[model samples]
Target: MPGTTTLWRPTGPAELDLVAASGWREWPPRLPEQPIFYPVLNVDYAIKIARDWNVPHSGAGFVTEFDVDTDFVSRYPVQQAGGRDILELWVPAEELPEFNRHIVGTIRVTHTFPETA
Candidate 1:
């Protein structure tokens, strides 16, 4: 793990299914309308989106964490989309295949929405 960085991605059930179908090794390619594949820098940011947005819109949500080769991911600069904590890397849709190849290990679900209430 020395040359790797961990990233989090908030995903819906459909995307999660695709990830599972990949044997949890890689992410699925983005759809034509999707222009970028974004992975957040922190767990808090990932949790917020998965709980507040994905659950509401897609009926379920999850926060996934994975490691990627640091050098490979360095190609894209970190993007601060909103608050100081809202940090993410935007990999162009076309480059996601290459991005997937850089994943260091299995993707894991760190959190899931709709907690017992």
Candidate 2:
């Protein structure tokens, strides 16, 4: 436990598909219209987005858990945007490898949600 580090990313089923296909090796790329990769500071926040926004709008959503290098905490400053606590990293498509470098362990699916409407 002493050497372990963990982080969470909540996403929709489509994104989770990409993650599974990647062997849990990468976070799915943001859409051309999306500008940032937001991994939040807590599971509750992730769940809020997954349920209130993702599942309803996208038909499905997920809550994922993974370990990130401890240094990641220091590398990016925590952000509170739109009144939510998140880590907002400007990870353009070209910079994905650099972003992946900070992720240290398996990206596992911890929870899944089905479309409610």
Candidate 3:
């Protein structure tokens, strides 16, 4: 806990605004069709998703950085596919606040997408 630190989430601009407006405390509720909240492990993966996926479709993409208790995060499972280096947790909508409580600081938008094209 001493040296260990933050996790990052890549999302659309709408979600970032929601996080900011909610007093930097909670994540917005997931839509009916959406069941999981994914906070990726690395900025590169986050940026890739934000740029290639979120920005093109949503018109605005954002990467959010925050600190969470690694112990709390360790309680969940991590998903990793073949070559993606996409380590992430699948936090269910109902458990979001529980996850949020571990977050140490205000989630800030680290990057905005479409740096080109």
Q: Which residue ranges in model 1 land beyond 4 Å of their true spot?
A: 115-117
Lowest summed lDDT across 10 adjacent residues in model 2 is found at 83-92
TM-score of each: 0.95, 0.82, 0.88
Q: Name the candidate, 1 or 2, with the larger TM-score value.
A: 1
TM-score of 2: 0.82
What's the residue-level lDDT of 102 in candidate 1?
A: 96
Q: Which ten residues in a row have the lowest lDDT in candidate 3?
A: 1-10
What are the lDDT figures for the candidates, one per model? 0.94, 0.73, 0.81
What is the C-alpha lDDT profile of model 3 across 1-117, one tens digit per residue?
Answer: 433357788888788788988887778988888888888888888898898899887887888888887777888777894456978888998899788877876788889875455
Count of clashes in candidate 2: 0
* Per-residue lDDT of candidate 1, residues 50-81 (tens digit): 99999988888899999999999999999999
Better of 1 and 3 by TM-score: 1
Candidate 2 residue lDDT tens string, 1-112: 2243566777987788899998998887678877677777677777778877888878987888877766654566667666645444344566666777667777987778
User: What does each candidate score in C-alpha RMSD?
Assistant: 1.6, 2.6, 2.0
In terms of lDDT, model 1 sits at: 0.94
The pairs that clash in candidate 3 are: none
